[model samples]
Target chain A: MAIYSYDGTFMGLMSLIGFLEDKQINPVAICDKNDLVTDLFEEQEDIKTDEKRARELIGRIVDHICEPAFDRIVYGFLSQINGFEMAIFNYLHLGLTAGENVERLAGDRRVAPLRRLSLRVGREVHRLKGFVRFAQLADGVYYAQIRPDHDVLPLLAPHFVQRFADQHWVLHDLNRSRAAMYDTHQCEIVILAAADSLCFAENESHFRDSWRRYFQTIAIAERKNRRLQQQFMPRRYWPYLTEMAERVR
Target chain B: MILADSAKYDVSCASSGTFRQGRANTLGNATYSGICHSFAADGRCISLLKILMTNICIYDCRYCINRRSNDIRRTLFTPAEIADLTIGFYRRNYIEGLFLSSGIVKSPNDTMELFIHTLKLLRHRYRFNGYIHVKIIPGASAELVHQIGFLADRLSVNIELPSRQSLAKLAPDKTKESIIVPMRQMAGEIEMYKMEKKKYRHSPNFSPSGQSTQMIIAATPESDYDILRLSEHLYRKMNLKRVYYSAYVAVNHDALLPANPRPQLIREHRLYQADWLLRFYGYQSHEIVSESHPQLSENYDPKVNWALHHLDFFPIEIHSADYEDLLRVPGIGMRSAQKIVFHRRAANLSRQDLRRLGIVYKRAQHFITINGRFEGGQSSLLHSLLSERKIERARQLHFDFNDAPSAVQPSITGEL
Candidate 1:
């Protein structure tokens, strides 16, 4: 069985899709070069990042199919993280094999694993944005700690730049111990320990008091479903939710 | 995972289309803007990023997707990752806000620590001022739920099942004691926040958006009436934000559990209608179902059914019926009923006016009178009218389910 590999990018996955469309070849698996590699398939095809090829492939899919579906297939391929390039190749192989009656033919057996991957990646990306809580350091630099599902810190810097375009802050993806520090003048990624990172602002407590109070007020009590609550806002995440610490022992 | 996680929070609990704006650019347009899908794995849908801090579990519930014995792939995120991702998605406008949930990875304290770290990082670290909803891990120490209430825009915990016996059968690791105690603790703190806010302007309010919970349907033998009755009590007693219904999917096969996939979408749909009636419409759980009425008709909606059961109230003159009377009319939803009240202040409404107000005169005409005249022929024909209405509703719901992208949802706990 042949292994189709990519340069571990979105376009790379598309190029593989292009290959599946034109040929009847069914690659046994897809893998990404970034994660650990397996010795199952000795033969590997790298979907080179050709600007023209990638564009034409994506355009072809969009011209005929849903753009989001095409994107999902690519992202689903990425979520494999391990042997992703191989998975993408297989997924595309299965998708192309289904051809027109695609959704019906593939069903849960092929579609679920891929969609689940895209969803997993998308959900983690969204949750980290909400759960990443920062505190003030003595140096006037804002510092925060987080433990993420993936090595997501690298994928998250541009957003901080866009949102807090004017502010100075430090966001440490605590799981990886690497941080993105946006100083007023420049932004750099840094790493720090939980012990060395404790710092505060003059009104840090005051600001938290306001935030904590606000958090308490908005939730409608008439709808308290603990299981639903735990499913979304799991207990493990409480350490990072403020106010819990405010009244902390 | 976000779909799975939506089961954790009630805020993202919607399953329909938004108001239809023409596709200025796209091919199709939803009448409603923010209806999401249900969890197929759990029959919950909504465009919510439902996920866990970590999937490791201390208590293995038999019905849960993240239970310990299940070998489903598990993952956890750093606070930075949760915060960063939320902002990025928010900017992309793919989501409304963050709905953060986690499995107990370690001790309750340790688990809560990570939760706070992520929420704080999202707020303080990322400076992400957006919709953030979190859960009050029930077993954590006292100050935990109290503090969580302060940080979270909305807070919640799951009832899981309606009764303690059911929960015990499927989820031995969880206890009503551990669950209800923290929930009560958070409720008290939030209530106190309101009290303090009035007295001391400086006192911060806790859980400002409020708290909500989900009850898993089909996990137990609890009937719709039983669920609605329980929902009524929760709403009145707990002052809950929303009582979410997560139709149970058989995640594990246990002797104590059935492989119930979910309330068929219709069942889920009916419950939502029943829930809306309880919350918005002036209908009591008893008015819809009782010891005499053990279940919703499933054929006619609870409202029409209510109208059928009580004929004395029918032929209610549009110009004469009070707000409560007008609310009882089939096809006259809360919005329509409110519209009628406002419109009637200027002029006396007639049968023509009810049709103009977007009230489905087909279902309501039999039960309501216009000024002094009732246009709906006879009460006997009303029976067929009721059954026909059921067919129409089923068709609409089917069209809704069929038209919606199936890859993202199943037709149960959620869809939008």
Candidate 2:
């Protein structure tokens, strides 16, 4: 009967859901403000993001459903898949009522879509954890640029922060114009207007050359299988991989 | 690069099995689920910085690229140099950690001492906490082996050959006793340390990721039965974390080894599949292979072959079967079986629901029934359809056609 819109943030979506439940109205669709495509038959309303309501709903979701279901909602929101807002709406609607039994309905249509989105997001997060290639910049900060299909920079910060705790680094997502900067002690996600090209350290090329040579020498010539290599490290990731990068000579 | 090339034949590059959080002063951490930084052209994972400390060997193993008589460029990395390289790569996110192996320069004890020195530099001087998988030198003294175990996350000793006779023929200086005695000692020590840690909270860890070993396949005339039996023994009796199977690639030619050696990649693939059945699927080796069928089926996977042989086990009701029974189906993997068991408790599963639950319905549809409705057509002709699908997959992967060394061919699947 109605279409609901928000400001395209996770908090905004959570607030809109909380507002809808309190009002006892089920919208025909839920979407971000920028993504709303109004239909002639349905009335549209934009919900303001309420921090208190969003936090309360999130707390309730973790307490009632499980921590994993909360993670499912967070990752599904990051996936940016089409109709993910509605999928989360339906999933939480069932989850809040069914309590812990929501996840047991894995094959149910309402829950399966959100689960699939979370899985896709999780797979990308795992792949990027390895695929991220860092190069030492001129100022001693290690910098890496990635063009991942999903918004996964927030998910990747904790891993790199723990692994490279003593090093300064920046992981920039070129597609989103955002970066996660680690300053030897803490990590913060920041927005960048335009991430320009960086100058490498004097001996940066030496290590890169050594790595490329080592990569080539490590493969057994008798079992050379490009298809399998491509399957694991897909061609989309090859542009940034030092080993898979085209030889300049 | 020369050291890495010398050590490339080692196929075990796993960086899993230990979860160490990063300390305040340390440089790295480890995850229980391993991460592959990159895949090589051979489709193998390049997890850690897999390289050798040196490429100078005293023994002349015929199948080894680093044998004493072979004329090749030899290289040695100073302990400081290797530590520096590992730290640099770790900071750059190029590797999980280091997998350090070496050719015995003078003696086993000396080589082990050298490895321990590098590990000490990494652990104490550099304060590195990442995963390190070190190779235990066969014939090393027990004290030295125990010293290295405390510094590394995982340890391994390459059996090199499948059997004692093959070891005698190919690696004349090595013996089965030399290889296995160290393996047994390491297993016992790892067990003891685990028990100690269970009681004591602050006990220093000793090879917390446990031990693994590798054996070369097809270089000697050992059947798949011989190789898998040894792997099964290592898993059951030795409490090994993993057993890697490396198909013979003709790096060196000698009278004792096969001439014009075609790498038995397909056979290696089948053995890995069979190895999975043993470790994760609760299958015994004898059930997979025996005196009658010494080799696995080239036309079908080990699970599918077992399913075809035991036809009475099929037509399992997806709704009513236990988790263990669901795993016996050819295509129902551990994850899918768990999902089925979890979801079917709430409501009945339909044919459509199986696909949504992540089942490879193309393969599972033939073995399972939905709501007591048996839809797999003509049980007698089921194997042909499975074998045909497998052959089509093999063609797509471009696994060599001539690699099928087994006597059974696709034409015989109807009889099977």
Candidate 3:
């Protein structure tokens, strides 16, 4: 069987898996179109993203398997970790054959890898939910910039939308160069390179300073454990945290 | 900064158990699973904007930094100032919400009135729907307590010291009756409101997140038995959502208080671990500690210690044992026990399968047997192996503050 490649979009990956299952061909490897190589020793086939096919496969997974299984697949794909595509394909292959029993096989090697990757993405999403700090922009829109490990913008969008329904806010994932913009009525994800030009509001610094003071004073002096503090709130995330970040200008 | 500094000693920063969705006009909302916006230098979760309304006091609580005898700077924030600060910080996602605590200024009734006014400003004028944790001052009238319950998400009245004698020594002004009265009143009101909501849909919630209280540990001569037994009583009788144990940090020099008292974090950690057992695990106060063993072992965790003492309960056949039985095992947790039960119904589980299900096989191997094949060497060996990990961990990671095997927590979810 030839190696299969598809567009990197989640829909494209689903379509590729659906096409492979239908053809009864076990591909050596499944990869994104960008990563596909024209090897002289091996043959490669490129598949286009099919919306209907992807929807049908997702519907079947939800019906035959469980919604949580489908959620695992989506989250695993979002992880963008190394060789995640193949791991997800294997998970899906087992899930399709085993039906809902695939969940019971959480200990199974094929299923466990996907579960691990999905949990990694889930944890990062959970962390960024609290880690993401928004500063009021000069235009009165709340702006936050993050560089999370996974492509968790889509997962983080619904939470911020529900929590900040009446306010205008933008959650910018600097790692992926994508932003989720919300304007009270609607929320949309768009590609944005940088937000260096935007200025913070006049009172933003004052509030930030107060938060910094609160953060410093809240800690018990005798119970000072910098190691433990760094363990919970890692040094990598300190750059963007309002309390941890150093004053600019 | 002054208000926050005075309020820093309060360890209850939980913002969980209340779900208030954002409305058209509201400034914020509460999440059922609380969010920690930041972590402090002491490895504590910075969930709420913990601050006092005022630090000026009429009483002399020896352990408190805001005691009347202290020569420290005292400050007070107007109700409008607190409301503005809460909204300002909330809009920037700097905090979960306001954690309004105050020292006794004039009387508990006057202080409670001020709290109610501040809460009203946040709830009505500002239209803030987020989590608000209010400190219910002891000796406050039931009328004032009833009114404030409707405005806040969670209410707590700090017990401060463990025993009545300790209360007398450390906080003479705070009588046992004064504290328990508000707690009992709030618990009854919460239960009544929960019942009322079933009958009338629009019935407002009376502290939707329920009530929690805190007690300072290690300052007095109270044993682990004394603290845990009191916690059990509070949980059963008052129906408290949580009982926080703050390690005594000596900020005051008093003959009654411990001299140069360092915050007993390890003891505090062990108490929290035992607290989890009491709340989540089906362990009673007597089961954990008794007159014979008043103090918890500094070496092993409460669970491990329990497993070691009860030898006959070990060698539980994984295939035959139920969920509750599995929970008693050294390595098996609630999540892992559930997985074992679920998986064994479909197919036979192997040793490797148990490991995959998130069980600490090294710890659990002694307690459980797979298909009647015991891998645990002997009773004496089981005891050593169970505590070996904690011993090794203590030696290697001395700075690791949390008793949990996992990484330190950023949010106080009140989990085991």
DockQ leader:
2
Worst 10 residues of 2 chain A by lDDT: A240-249
Model 1's alpha-carbon lDDT is 0.62
lDDT of 2 by residue, A1-249 (tens): 689999999999999999987787888989888967867888999999999999999999999999999999999999998999999999999999998789988878889999999999999999999999999989999999899999999999999998988889999998999999989878999997554567999988988888888999999888899889889998888888888879322
Residue B378 lDDT, candidate 1, scale 0-100:
51
TM-score quality measure for candidate 3:
0.94
Point out where model 2 deviates above 4 Å: A37-41, A247-249, B379-416
What does the lDDT come to for candidate 2? Answer: 0.88
Local distance difference test, candidate 3: 0.87
Candidate DockQ scores, in order: 0.01, 0.79, 0.66
In order, candidate lDDTs are 0.62, 0.88, 0.87
Which runs of model 1 end up more than 4 angstroms from their true locations?
A1-249, B1-11, B14-48, B199-202, B261-263, B379-416
Colliding residue pairs in candidate 2: none
Superposed on the true interface residues, model 1 gives a C-alpha RMSD in angstroms of 17.6
Q: Provide the DockQ value for model 2.
A: 0.79
